[model samples]
Target: MNVTLPPTRSLLVAGALGLAVLAAAAGGWYWYDAQQRRVAAAYAEVMTRVYAVQSPQAPADARARAQQELEQILARHPSATPVGEAAFELGNLRYAARQWAPARAAYEIALARAHSPTVRALARTSIGYAWEAERDWGKAIEAYQAVGREVGPKDFLFDEVQFALARVQELGGQPAAAITTYQRLLKDAPNSVRVEEAKQQLMRLGARAQK
Candidate 1:
């Protein structure tokens, strides 16, 4: 009986193929990481410009430049990790300019792009504020209500959303709803920073929280 041996050339080909696959995977990861780093650097640069506009002595063109750069980031890297944050900054610039329609549009983009719950919540709340700025109480209430429904009570922004909802309801000629919302805030977020404010609002509304 003769013993047959497996071909060594076939074994070498298989090993080379495995190494190639691993090299390809590593190259792909390196490319992704490099792209992310570039996105982060761009985001940081835009944020610096954004924050610079907060100074009372900021240059008149500071906000415009910041807004322009942020828009460029959105246009250039629409699917990047920082796209949502850039959109939020753009929304803030528009909001400060009292461009309510444009502000809400930017915030809508933030909401669509952001993966973080906090960012999404902030964008949603800002949308409500933009409506409030426009004196569109009904739409403001709807936006705030959407936040309440989507975010949990344990979320850090939940109390703020509740307060906004209550305030909008009151201004929208729905005192009963406002009172109920205040009571809900009082119940759901007893230790929130807004708790005292909620109590004051309840008092002014001639309502008390249920035990």
Candidate 2:
């Protein structure tokens, strides 16, 4: 004899399957949520340590603690977003100490982990500053130029990157290029903070600033 489940039994089976699926989805979401929270927490902790090192009023111990914490972040979260942040902070600390080479290395790490062009441009600029600190003018110009070449015109960093690139060109023995860059910036962004500096630099370079 053939047997079939009643309508009630069939409905119960379907409902159970639906509830199981819902539970599974809930569990998966919870796991993702927890992972995101962990990443956020790590970023926050790293920022705290970095700020401590950045603060001039912070004691020597604060610097030491910050270094230790940064190392831990790098060691543990090798691929997390905050690893880039930690590296960036470490670069700032080293730059403050005038340790040019190490600062460049840290900035490079930051560049590797940067998720956006804005962050990449900023890291490149910092690398240029490190090169300038070391008196490596050619590399400084290269770094700054890379930012201009890679970043979009719509980016907020565009003008600042150009200003930095121009400064590096001047320092790299390309005074004429630097003057041209400054003039362009003046014409394009009259309201920029760099405008006054550009005018001053143009005057120093014996170039007439446009009215």
Candidate 3:
């Protein structure tokens, strides 16, 4: 008679197979999570390094290298959390280079994808500046107004948006409106450094302060 394997042996073999499958799945998940973290960390580090180089004389090659690295990271991990921040940084670089159109596009993309309200506000401000660079006073006013409303009256950025909006109003042939906005900003932001500037602008607009 031929010997046969015990039923318990087959049960043990099945259990081992199930355990192996679970282990493989766990390992794959861990690897994927680790990869995502690595990508995010790399992106943050690159952005920090790029921002740290403050000299106007900083080599163009360095900036180009940083951009290339950021591009590669973004290409590899399109959905990374830092991608929006990277786009914002790139927009700043382009803006500093006076590349208004591309800077505006990049800032728009960053604003659309930004997860943080602070970052979105910054992108909005930058977009307003880009419009100003292009001398599109109407668009600049719109952008500044949007940013001002979003940032609220108590925020530090309030003064900046107010100033930008006033300038846009002046350029849009609404000097009276500009004077009114400046006067309001001066009253609201009495301690702000821009208060004096606002007063000067009001004077130039022939707007006398009410007694």
Quote each prediction's TM-score. Answer: 0.78, 0.73, 0.83
Candidate 1 lDDT, 1-211, residue by residue in tens: 9888668998899999999999999999999999899888988887887888967677758887888888887888888888887888899998987899999999999999988878888999999999999999999999999999988778887888888898889889998899899899888778888888888888888844343
Could you give me the TM-score of model 2 versus the true structure? 0.73
Candidate 3's C-alpha runs over 4 A off are: 1-18, 207-211
Clashes of each: 0, 0, 0
Clashing pairs in 3: none
- Candidate 3 lDDT by residue in tens digits, 99-181: 89888888897898889888889999999999999999999999998997787667878998898899888888888889888
lDDT of 2 by residue, 32-123 (tens): 88987897798797787678567788786777677667767777778776677678887877787778998888899989987765666678
Ranking by lDDT: 1, 3, 2
> Which lDDT value does model 1 have at 73?
78
Q: Pick the winner on TM-score between candidates 1 and 3.
A: 3
Model 2 root-mean-square deviation: 5.0
- Could you tell me which 10 consecutive residues in candidate 2 have the lowest summed lDDT? 202-211
Residue 148 in candidate 2, Cα distance off native in Å? 2.2
lDDT of 2: 0.80
The per-prediction CA RMSD against the true structure, in angstroms, equals 4.4, 5.0, 5.0
Clashing pairs in 2: none
